[model samples]
Target: MKMIIATLAAVVLMTTSTVAFAEQFEVINTEGSSVPGCQVTNSCFIPHTLTISVGDEVIWKNADVATHTVTSGTQRGGPDGVFNVSPFFPEDAFSHIFDEPGEYPYYCLVHPWMKGLVIVQDAMADDDNAETTPPPDDGDQKSQMDEQRATPTYDAEHFVTTWIISTPGESIIIPTGELTGTYSVDWGDGTITTEAGNAIHEYDDAGNYTVQVYGDFTSIRLGGDPTNAVKLHSIDQWGMIQWTTMESAFRGASNMVYGATDVPDLSNVTDMSHMFAHAHSFNGDISTWDVSSITDMSSMFASATSFNQPLESWNISSVTAANGMFRGASLFNQPIDSWNTSSFMDTSFMFLDAVSFNQPLDSWDVSSVTEMSYMFTHATSFNQPLDSWDVSSVISTSSMFWFAESFNQPLDSWDVSSVIDMERMFESAHSFDQDLSEWHIIPDGT
Candidate 1:
């Protein structure tokens, strides 16, 4: 009995390690979990089964109205003692790292009908084979720094984001994250630190210096704080760090930051809300970014005055909340009609004060949108067709087209019966004269 108990304890032990090349995956606990039909179709968790690498992390966002638990083990087998999130409310999130290689099943305590499985495979097996490979000639081989820059950084080997700081008294502060892993920071001024908890490293003299950070991280938020964002000169190398959220990463960065322009591995990122808010003068080459995994892009480029990059290739199929995505971007006028918004629900303040945005968005799938309050307020140059929208799921359209001077599109074919708030929906000096007498308001609407 003692040996059996010890074996069970070992299986549930938490082993945390940072890997640079690991990926991030997200699983939604889907809406309407309080009912019984979700289990019949195996749709409690979207993509009921997920497979990931050992070092990869799985973030679970609770979309159901009721609070649910993501406890390891089935309702019949009881708790396996692997991991458990007691009670997470609607819109809350819980994440777990799969350090061991095996199949781990998790179920909801509140609702036994909900179940999901995760298969973790060891990603280090390929690294062993890479060691047996022959090396290149001396002339063809690059330096250690060059090799690090040319490849993705991860915990499997070792690499970090190489930052170039040229100003004296300038500091870089590192923020804390959810998971605990070993982090090393090389200040490049003979100071090497292993702790990455709100680490504020200051340069005493003005000179070109390289700062490298190696480790596993999930959230590197407001990387350079709002007050010290100007001090951040450049991120010479953005290593392959499996980040889950980049929200407010550069909240108030100035134009001096000329890096972070490379196409990063963003397969696991979910929340990008306020990522580049107030980042004036930032016009980088990020036209090829894969944005398929992003769910929250609220205020992503808000107040970014000089950003006009081509973003027609971004896969935004998974986005759900895009509130204020391009708000106050005075000079941005990119064509993004080909993007997918089938999963979008909340797009409030999406284009508020975006004066130069006049593109074709007739092909967008906004049938899933709910709250469109202030979506196009002050967007003076927008004129498009939105007559085929299925607005039966929307509850609020307050100030939706307020102050949009050039919009005179036909929206008479919309179903406004579900909208409870339509105050000032088209209130402005606008040319909108469409007949809305056929539209019916909800019972509780004004």
Candidate 2:
């Protein structure tokens, strides 16, 4: 009979121990009861520092009839909107699960003096059953909050479109739609559809127009159509493909298009070369482009007459070759001092007919240059300092400053001993006044 009593007492003790270990933590007032307010003697239940294993949960019960709150520290503050609570009220409870191992401090929003600490131990200590309880609504609320912090707004009044054409003239409204259906011509009176399925617009006068295209339109090849001379205005936030070399790659003629008169939103473009070649009237600001992914800018603004945007801020430091990059451009006068030309090899005629460029270029590292013939022949006003340039690897200087009519600077420091040609180095330069006593040998043996 005594043994039976002892066995029953042991079983009861074990059951009580199991129940206590199952609950991670419980917060009650000083009285130690499950009631809202603490004991009369101790009004507050202070759990200053708590050390729990990963996946452990902590529950805060409103021991006092007054309202209270639980707010995590700034470092691990969960969501921006739900970071605070009100007065300590009755039956108010807040709970949080510690899934990550870290030191998290929290406090009551209503009473700054009330604080708590939670230290979550690493899960590796107890490998088994470390999974935390998922939130009641899963993670839907957190996901929505993250997305709301990301999207940008749009503007309509500041948007404009400018087009460049092959022929000299005509006016027309470009219809916006998926690249399908018969092409139509808008002459301000009525719309006329063509049998060739090509939208034909006529502009008898010479001016610019701001065209608007609404909705989702894709596969658009701007300035590729032979009879089209329109340049889409600002790209704003839209995605568009401006130019191409292949005729069949777009809906218009490949070679007939001349220029791009609009500022394309190249925020989405990975390449920007040859997008404005043969364009004569494209003069817009492109100094703020993010061209980090562009690998080929071969003839980007070649022959563009009015393109004078500064590109000194671009990360063209990775460009390896700049062959004919700005061959016939006439109005590009921005400084190229910020360019990293260490990887560049081909700079032949880079500024061939660029007449408006007279900035100082003494800092350019041309150590890898092998050709300089005709590079500055027609550049009339470009007589800056070229004394410090290393032309040791140069093989040709034939017509370098031939037609440069305003070149009167000294070239005594230039090493032309290894140059194979100096044919017309001073052809039409009527303003030649600098002494050539230091010149190794005149091409005509003068």
Candidate 3:
């Protein structure tokens, strides 16, 4: 299923930013490492000792629940000037470029027991047996003495991808079988006009390159390698790509964030599920995006911890599924009560764990919604008047405000005639002591 979506997106898929010559590697601060047990098991940083070639990039991903740092030096000696990452939270990442060759040791300053080492080797050494030549000017410039690197074969399995150009003479396979519509590819170095299948150009030098494709297509897999983005940095263009296939285009590109002033054309788009889910550092001002045609918005900004833009001008009249749209978006707190949701439904998990969200929602027309499960669970700051909302159409309000520590409002006028399940709807909501003596519950069996 992933490959199919990737292939469809391959038609207009273009990786914008230029990557480095050396390959990228990931080091994870493994799950359940915040406690003391991980240090005893030597499982603090997965592969506590990582060996890589010079010029390679190492991305440290925090998969643990607690915040951590990737600081250089030992516990006693303190931090060396190697590479130090400030406090980064779970699902967030920090990358460092390694240019010099050496044995660099690092540890978490907050947790001294968590230790790791990076061994950088000079991969392009001037050997006695190999001959070297100047890099050809046709492609990216190759580093001196980088001659013995083997050519990378293109994989047919991956139909859609944002490439990280490592070695020269590598083949970039574009599925000519798909892409019936017109599109163009700017392969960073230059543009490729011809729609060739596998006979794509190979660089004469051993450096790096990037690409951007724009055309009409079915769908594109959300960018990055599922959960992590290697070289995805920016979206410089949206081109003339005409389609609703931009679903999950930048789902997990943690590196693509901020200073994004370019507003994309979304007139042709409809479904936008998981569009920016887990894009940790993205805080681009897209408050004016034309999202009127959009319908499904499930998980669009889920886990996008840095996104906090105004959405008051958005026309959500056509939207339906809004479940998990702002789940885990801790910094998002904007007034969007003015959005028209007359045709909307399914508001489950809309603000789950959105800790900083505290806005007025009494004006929202939620009369058409059917499922309102977990709508404000863990939204610690959400406390507003919801008695004005007409929830007669809602069938499930399960876990709606669970753990919302600050929510305390009147709900005497709410209609629960159609509700079937209200299980744990107000559990752990510390300040919620609303009287519901006038309300009546309708069981499913009835």
- Ranked candidates (TM-score, high to low): 1, 3, 2
Q: Which regions of candidate 2 deviate over 4 angstroms?
A: 1-226, 229-271, 293-296, 435-446
What digit string (tens of lDDT, one per residue) describes model 3 on residues 186-298? 56566556443222555553322445564433344445355334334444344344545456767887645332234556787787888888877566667877888899888
**Model 1, TM vs. native:** 0.61
| Native-to-model Cα distance after best TM-score fit, residue 365 in candidate 1, in Å | 0.9
Lowest summed lDDT over 10 consecutive residues: which window, candidate 1? 1-10
Q: What is the TM-score of each candidate against the true structure?
A: 0.61, 0.45, 0.60
Q: Pick the candidate with the highest lDDT.
A: 1
- Which residue pairs of candidate 3 clash? 14-212, 14-213, 222-248
Worst 10 residues of 3 by lDDT: 1-10
- lDDT, residue 46, model 3: 86
Q: Which scores higher on TM-score, 1 or 3?
A: 1
Clashes of each: 4, 29, 3
**What are the lDDT scores of the predictions, listed in order?**
0.71, 0.50, 0.68
- State in Å the error of residue 97, model 2: 63
With candidate 3 superimposed using the best TM-score fit, by how many Å does residue 118's alpha carbon deviate from the native? 30
